[model samples]
Target: MGFNNWNSTHCRAEFNESMVKGIADTFVAQGLKDAGYTYVNIDDCWALPDRNASGDLVPDPARFPHGIKAVADYVHSKGLKFGLYSSAGTKTCDVQGFPGGLGHERQDAELWASWGVDYLKYDNCNNTGADAKQRYKAMGDALAAATRATGRPILYSICEWGSNQPWTWAQGVGNSWRTTGDISDNWSSMISIAHQNQSLAPYAGPGAWNDPDMLEVGNGGMTDTEYRTHFSLWSQMAAPLLIGSDLRTASPATLAILKNTEVIAVDQDPLGRQGTVVSDSGGLVVMSKPLADGGRSVTLTNETSSTRTVSTTVKDIGIGGASSYALKDLWSKATSTTTGAIGAPVPAHGTVMFRVTPGSPVPPPTGVNQLSDLPWTSAVGGWGPVERDRSNGEQAAGDGRPLTIGGVRYAKGLGTHAPSDIAYYLGGGCSALRVDVGVDDEAPNTGSVRFQIWRDGTLAADSGVRTAADPPVRLNADLKGATKLRLVVTDGGDGITYDHADWADARLACGSGPSAGTHELSDLAWESATNGWGPVEKDLSNAEQAAGDGTPLTINGTVYAKGLGTHAPSSVAYYLGGTCTSLTTRVGVDDEVTTKGSVDFQIWRDGTLAAESGTLTSADAAKALTADLTGALEVRLVVTDAGDGIDYDHADWAGPRLVCG
Candidate 1:
């Protein structure tokens, strides 16, 4: 729905005849149409800056040769619906280009109706804060009155970004309205949006829905596990299923998530009821929705940085009528039955969504006990911000750590001394809590702090008074029968001067957690990502094929790694290990049927290309290569996108190895 170089770089959506046709072609081929994801909507920046002499919005001459009607016809020919974009203001969001339909709402609506447009995504931008409801209603009225035999009624979508709280008042004004800001291809953005939408649960239903922006499933910013959570949450919220990435070159994981029928069914449920949170703890949240078939869709989310096991009983999820339920894992497509409590092992930034049907209840599964990462989302209560970098009494805590751990601030009382209390949730499964308590090495230490674990206001363990230099006092506490955990800090001898505190590496220990992944690159830190190249994926089996021909990428006489795509001429970077002498991997495009996607692998050490490989194409000629990383602190691999974007571009580094010195 977004096109790059159109009017904005938003969504990286590039508008062109080939790209548009490519999306349309893949949407049908991928079977997204039958899944209730039929509409192919294009976002802003489609039209030129000025309309024709008759004041009619026209497609860019260079982008659309056959014009808008032809494009609409092409979409219709594929048995799919078409959508377009416009602005409520005088000029659209793209200030540099694209004329807005401010005074020409009726004319623009009539024109789109004539062109057989089935949907319209009206955005609010550059308006200098005009009346949102009135302007949007004007367009909505015009669309309703447009008389076009060829065009079906346009499903109006309002993109006000929740400025006027459209969910509260835009019931009949539009089919769906964005309830939040734009979403990026990352975990924090996705989680933030999900949290924001929790309040608007009552606003979405069958005829109308809450728009949380677009999907970033295939986007490379987050891992597959996180993407699955993103998709599942969006589905649970009944948000629009707009694909924002290139479908033609989607990864296997992305395709699997997009084609999830059980999840999609929840979104398309006839009941049209949005799932609401049944139980919410720090990082653990359980959401449930009553389905049309007397079933329930439950999503147990561990929205944290480390792995955790979130558990809840069937009664807790409000399925009292059913003694037990047949539970199906929507992401894994695995089935199992559960009775009293359903405890699932959820990875960091991951979710375990289950479709529950009435059945005989079964006992809890083994290894159900789980540990937890740091609390990141708002579900985790009792946390605030402290300027750790501020230097007065003690502000010197600097390994140059990111301001937030797992995107959460651990400091409190920046300028004036203010004692604050923060608490973390303790699931019954937790055995103990572990964290480092300290004062900002550089901030003023006018206040002494106390750290204690509390069980319903009863003190279990306490660290009497800790100062900046004596911070990180190790403390152990019994979490058994602990219903709540607290970190209550008090001001020292001075009256609220400067009491910056830190809780570093805060986590809970339970029975079991996620094992160290077998991914070869998980231990290293990701660096830069070019427009074409993304962070290196670990142990991806898809990267083992030749680009043009479907064959394995063999270096010399050995085959290594499974799915590291070196099929494109793109550069990727990673932090070097302490004792790693050399790094080895195989590079070649997967053996698919395509041309111009041949890639070249160039290893760079400290910004210089240290090793090189010739153009490896679908010719099935792949060389197992190794680079001497020696004393290099950082290593970068530059792979060309085959001088093409991602057309048949499948570059992989299967079984990458690190040789210890």
Candidate 2:
């Protein structure tokens, strides 16, 4: 049903040759035949000299003494499968390296298949693009052809490392897709991989699965309990069980941990549903996946160093059965027909897997809805920035508008601002905060902005700016009930402005005042008498100056505006940027000072032009003429005159700075 490519890695020439020989020898010594680990996939650095003059993969003649064919025969003799590694791009990950597959896809695949290869782990290292799907498809086609050419049904393993969740398209290309980065041999590394795969279960099915790199079950830096948990979780998650430890010289404890058949059965269940987390305790978690005949497999893992009792009930498995179920401790062979579930003392970074059959009489959970489904409550008072709100005199949130919260200004510029530097001057008693931002496909440097969160002037979290839609970061802090929050945009610098910028949302956790989300931008007004170029005008009468209502102009329930320098020198100007469907610019007649100037109106959308206005010259007549900003959502108008002496009337807007649709 499923395959385990878990093996001990052998890199150097001597080690590689010896390890291959040892794997063949240990097959029976380790009692692997009785267990189900039949595939011993060699990771990187097993071949010699990389390739021949014709670009064919030439195994290191000495290391692969008899070549790959001999290795394959030896493995097959032990009734085990063999796998090889290569890159979708030209260079393989090995330090000595092989020819990158970029231009020679057909030749590489043909060579591997000719070597009697049973599996191919094609990784995506140097290749990237929206056209990545097509590139992977091309390689997949080559592999298929290679299979035909060599008359082998070689299993295709796409090792794009989950860059695009290849699971969505992996079946069409290969059997498994590594859904995370290369895993290290430690508890933290293993737990991290297990945690990240919880949401990817829906994409796994028969013949297709999420790969957590490889198994580190028997590797050092973890205890027997942790390794047990590692094996149990991989089995329950239906993950491709590729082991990455030294299998030949494994300790009795390590071999025993790797060959647990009970865990293997749960992994190889025909249903192929990936496990979902049922309960979590710090680093400990319980995950369950459905089995074929109304049964479920569960893994209880303690990612911490100390042993802890972790438990999960039947209802948490997403099943409301008819009064009973069978609980079988896969590792201990302890069977119990109970009403609810099992509680096991999991060792640090270790796990326990069990098979639960519905209608077998398990213990009933006493507290209904006890599984903490509260959707990760904003960590008490840790609400981050949010969309704008305009209730009291306030207009919109900070998504677009500029605010000097606590003294630090998180404006649209690429400069470093430490979270601890935010002053207490910001109106809201905001001790904690968040910024609502999304990645724009148009901004290449979006990755350039790094936001660092601080608590009481100490760094809490530092995030490299990312534009992905989900996983909006909500950094938390120990404010100690303090009444101030700070944000330091480490990369907002000169020459960078995101136009569709809007305050998506902000919030605050427990304190004497209202919660953080309560004091939104809707509570304040942006009534500047002067355009920061002069004092407040209180009354709107002069044509030389203009001020806004501090209140944000909202569209689609968000406050979108140009931050910093509301008034500019006409020809050279910038506006807050983001995704906008349209933009409009309108100026009041009383806001224009016409001596002799030309105004240029432009709107940027999707990082390209959606609209623009020809220079509107007002040399003589002019009080002002509104641009009627109806269609442009993110708009900017610059008025300037080439002749130095000719004074042109100022062109500006007063009612709403800019509205985004």
Candidate 3:
């Protein structure tokens, strides 16, 4: 951990020799040096705009009148390290166009080594279209040679802005690689950069790390809550915590956040394992980092504007078999214990971090259960958090509606976007899993997703490709003797646009089948029915005025074997008898009309309008509709013409299903 002047002073007039010396002195005065902050780095504009007659870099006369070596000597005299900035291109990033260390890599390295420089922030600017790896490696090799000649190691920081994925190749070339663009002193900028850097956990470790720009903790652009989140997330990600604010003017709150030794321990841990996302539904995120000890550092972040309860389980964080776990609040220094769950009410733009130590080992629980009712080992989503009994709306948690797939609503299931993986520790107790999977109807007809079930890393079941237009496809996997179960969703050869996928009615049969039952609406007897043009047909589309005259139920060119097909101004009522919990279906103008019809669909629960689909046309895709039927005696499905007359207003309720005890 250290401090950099770029974010605070950035080429300003105040970035002089005295400022550098003051920072080093303040590091000693402010207890920062004792707390592990050593380096005081100078960024761009430190050097003159031109090279000297001997092709050597010259310190700017006004900024560093006594020269760069003098500043380095002062920092070293305080028992602190010094860092300088240069670019891999012809000039630095500043508008002043200062000379860079591109062709003079060896010379610059040797020059900085002689001046007691211990770190180099190599930037990317004005490069002459050369390969990124080659350019960065040149300076890396030069720094290695400088260390050998001077017997002083220099930390190389590559600032390529992730335009080239340095994480794939920067190991052994630089100590850390910039994984994103420059970070502004704002919550949006910091959190967005954190999201970009969170997924590359595998590339970060002891010697090599992912640099998501510098810390903006005390920059005043965000609240203290947001600043804590910034610090906690950076430390959790094992990022180089280079303070970007001016220490001389830093607030006590900023110093407290920066000097939280418990948090610093997570960053400076010997194992250096970067935390990985355990779950991110909506904006409530949970990350877990394994420490050198058997314990873990967990971070629960609230990215929303409102305070929310963010939570996870010890088993989810890769620690289990403990009778109870000790949780040390890294910021508050408060200690608590839990059997397995770790959670807290986090503030807006805030984070709750903990150092968790597992208790004595014990046997895990085992029984037939819904996966949602049980804690998962880990979960990672593409767009939003992996939800329970809700669709992946790609927003904040619980912002999604009921889990509806191709019009079938599931009262119990997982709602996740594509490129998601959710795991559970079965402990060889589960025998099988039965689930209905599909791209959620929320995506309309635009999504294509693949569902997979893995047992102990072996692919047990796979749904080839389920699109938004397809009905729910059921998969039954024999997970007998397997210790782990993983539910995975992929982009199905297509991109992940609008890929809201669902694992509907997922039942884990450890000792028996699911607790509740489900039934298709078309298979149930209706209490009453009325049609505008013909008798309502079962498992078919409305073709003419006669019953059974319609073909298979079809909407937006996608066919379904089960659903109620009728004309506009029609009503179909089912006697739910207060047994069912919810009704889910996709409603649209039947493709039989071929872009020449418009109608409105509505769902009524005992005379109350529960859900509606405003004005759907043959040209539009099917719309997902859901209604709560809990404790209701009857449910109604109604369709009407769009006030333009019932011309070709053939409507279909596609893949309607009801969940009941």
Candidate 4:
């Protein structure tokens, strides 16, 4: 996060005159302030080695030769705000040469105010286990008093990293509080921070926001796709948009991602509603945020490596009634209409962000079978304590549950020996439900655990019994008359012991009642991506994986798309269906790129040419590319060189895995 950039791309003493000037210029030149990225902050190591003779902090002359006031003035001239950083400890982090605001709270606040500092990122490091509330409150009060006297209202940000769980008491102490530690620029780090942020949803809003560190967009640590996911997650949760990279040297792709206006609107939404995880199955999670205009901001992310087909429905997002919403993809700006379900192929460590505008309501299809797009509702049965709070009435995880060795993440919440039920909001759409249930490694094997899914009051599905070593069991059963599902676990022939169970990858597949076109196939599986072999991508439309005409990519020969460059000869495979017979794809070189790469388009059915677009060049217009399924079990789209291998050739296969026959 980072205004200071932490240890990213810069060094401790790198905060200097040339650096601030360059950053200020970039802020204005890059339209950062105009795009709502208003604050330009310089973090730790900016101050002198120690306090001045008058007990006031000073910017290092060698670093900020003209002083911080000059820098603040320059930043102000850019029509943006200027921020500075310090700590609440005895000394700031890397204290060897930096001073902290231990006894200099008022002096520092007034100094910053006099210097026109509009923001303060007060950190907590090496502070020991001192009374955090009192320490932070002193800084907050000092800053407030400075504002009243100096006529400059500094936005106070508490970088406590949730050590004392600041969300519970930091409302009046800071404008935003760091809910997690410094975020490294990677998928796992981002996802882990996101998971913690999701649990703190109730603590975020306007003015008083939950800070998940800062943006790592231009850090070059993650792919642009993963960066999109990271950005979308932070915005959905109403976190502060602190730029942490060197904006002056940001790539065009990175800038495009950071300055996505539509997605930014979600973050700056006046309502300040924070989204939460509505569905998590097989590590594929869906986060839904309620926007101000009765619209919703939804992010579908894949945590597992390789590719995944992630799906969710309107009902899962808190929208009701059968309706087709105009789904606007924030990344690609592509819009589509779907009944209620949204099924798209998401690359590994990637995400699909959508701003769904409510469209015409209709009676959903009612005569086919498909997976339920609605999210599940969870409830725990019996016992509380240890992991549960009594006096505070808080939503604690295994807080008070007895004999609990440690907390385990279950369908409802984290706990073992749970008789918990995970109910799906099928909205009367699903006719059957299928789910895999298992006992996690946390199980102590103290007793047998019985897993069962009850449809209303009847037993719809059941996994007889399981021990610690047993893998997850699949429970497939009818759900037509079910009102709610109970994921009940019984302590077999013993008292409540270590009976940990999980409903892993639980799904409500359509069983005979969804209308035609209302349900898209959600049962398809995706293999991992291979560099030379390539991988099939899925989306309603993706400039990264689509022809310029906003159509599915045809992989016949070399072609050029927006994100993917011109290719050499390559082939990718996909599983259409058991009875698949025909394939339809919108294929051609994206009209945007000027490259005229030569490519041979051929579809191999069981290793033979099922269809061929003989020796094509980039001049050709986009058209329907089809391959006859005919007795073929495995199909591969072969993209080879027509003349030379591939130069600026990018071909995409969009839409679904394959349109079933």
Best by TM-score: 3
Select the stronger candidate by TM-score from 1 and 3: 3
Q: Estimate each model's TM-score.
A: 0.53, 0.53, 0.58, 0.56
The lDDT of each candidate is 0.64, 0.52, 0.86, 0.65
State each model's C-alpha RMSD to the native. 28.5, 19.5, 15.1, 23.7
Q: Candidate 3 — which residues are off by over 4 angstroms?
A: 363-661
Highest lDDT: give the candidate number.
3
Off by over 4 Å in 4: 1-4, 7-10, 95-97, 360-661
Rank by lDDT, descending? Answer: 3, 4, 1, 2
What is the number of backbone collisions in each predicted candidate, taken in the order shown? 59, 93, 4, 27
Compared with the true structure, what per-residue lDDT tens digits does model 3 show for residues 1-661? Answer: 8999999999899999999998999999999999999899999998889999989999999999999999999999999999999999999999999998778999999999999999999999988888999999999999999999999999999999999999878988999999999999998899999999998775677899999999999999999999999999999999999999999989999999899988999999997778878788999999888776667899999999999999998866756545688999998889999988899999999999999986654322333345676666556666656788888878656768888876677798889887777877677766667788998888967799899999988999999988889989888888878887889898887666789999987766553222257878888777679999989999999986777899888787788889999998999977654456898899888888985889999999755799999999998988999898885556789998989999999999999988886
Model 1's number of clashes is: 59
lDDT of 2 by residue, 248-287 (tens): 6678898777787877778888866677665665876777
Can you write out model 4's per-residue Cα lDDT over 1-661, one digit (the tens) per residue?
A: 2244553544456557777778778766777666787777888888777888998898888888899999999889977788898999888876364888867899889999999999998989867667889889999999999999989999999999988899878987889999998888877898899898886765566688888888888798899888888888888888887777877678998889888888899989886767767677888988777676657888998988989999998765656443467898898888898777876899988889999776633322332212223332323332221121111112333333222222333232223344343344444444554555565555566646777777766887767777766665667777664554555676554544555555543434332311223112222332212222233333312233433323433444434232222243656554432235666554544443455655666677544587776655667665456777643344566656676755655444433224444
Name model 1 segments beyond 4 Å from true. Answer: 1-14, 147-151, 360-661
Evaluate model 4: give its TM-score. 0.56
